[model samples]
Target: MSGIVTELWPYIVLILVGYLPNEVWRMLGVAVSHGVDENSELLIWVRAVATAVLAGVVAQLVVDAPGALALVPLSVRLAALAIGFLTFLVIKRSVFAGVMGGQAAMLIGGYLSGVSLMVP
Candidate 1:
């Protein structure tokens, strides 16, 4: 319905707004990386900024995920982060392992802490 779409428009805009900066950087990086040396200052700065942004995003997700983090204690969140880090190390930076391990840790830790949702 028109009313529903009006309500959702802000959320759609927010998603595109959040995504645009990262996607732009990615496209620019890809375009430049072909000709740029790996040790170049521009590449180094881009890598550093990208790393910082990724870390900030992950931290925000862990600390402020609306429904999920609110249902878990800080310790559980920290433990999940640690598990994700360890999984990354053990798997030689396998992104899938790190993500799945972190999610699994959060789910298990939340249930163990009796702070999770009670669903049938």
Candidate 2:
């Protein structure tokens, strides 16, 4: 037991230091948002801010992707994003379908580009 904890100490620290800090604000937001009107102006503003941030991050990843993601072509990345968004709209705003569609497109691109995937 102690040996396992010792080996996993870094992971435990990361959860406490990284995840916990961000999760606390999310939890607080949920708590505060309770009973608030979902379609209200405040919520709309929040959604807009979140969407803008997400778009910025996505744009950055597509334009200047780091590490393995950089291997995939920009055109392929853009295509995958488009396919995913189309799938989301077609599927009645199903986020799962959108993500799966995007991932499938990305994997297909990776295969076509000769990038290797490891299977355990």
Candidate 3:
């Protein structure tokens, strides 16, 4: 129905424009990695590069956040990051818990810092 299509348009667009493109590459990677040795030097290098990229992104977000995230004090962000990592470890390495903990910490810290969501 037109109503259903209209309501779901954004989700449909997201699947087509965002999810599918990335998923294809993920599937291709899985297919190609089937016979690859996990301990191979090439894989190790790839892992290291991936880790470095992720670390750089995290560092950038903390050091120079964009939009509303920038309103958060650097100390609060740093504390949130640490709390998130500790939550991850304390929760037996559950990434979901870590993310939630980080998000919660950020919200609490931001509130405590008197950051109004609507900054005139």
Point to the candidate with the largest TM-score: 3
Of 2 and 3, the candidate ahead on TM-score is 3
Q: What digit string (tens of lDDT, one per residue) describes model 1 on residues 1-120?
A: 999999999988877998786689789867867888878898788899989999999889777877756878988998999998899889989989998998899889988999737663
Off by over 4 Å in 2: 1-47, 118-120
- In model 1, what is the error at residue 2, expressed in angstroms? 12
Clashing pairs for predicted structure model 1, backbone only = none
Q: In model 3, which residue pairs have backbone atoms overlapping below 3 Å?
A: none
For candidate 3, which ten residues in a row score worst on lDDT?
A: 111-120
Number of backbone collisions per candidate? 0, 0, 0
| C-alpha-based local distance difference test score of model 3 | 0.94
Candidate 3 wrongly placed segments (more than 4 Å): 1-39, 117-120
| CA lDDT of each prediction against the hidden true structure | 0.86, 0.91, 0.94
Candidate 2 lDDT over 15-99, as tens digits, reads 9999999899999998999999978999899999999999999999888989989888888888889989999999989999999
lDDT of 2 at 89: 92
User: Candidate 3 residues 22-100, lDDT tens each?
Assistant: 8998899989899889889989998999999999999998989999889899999999999999999999999999999
Ranking by lDDT: 3, 2, 1
Question: How do the predictions measure up, each by TM-score?
Answer: 0.61, 0.60, 0.65
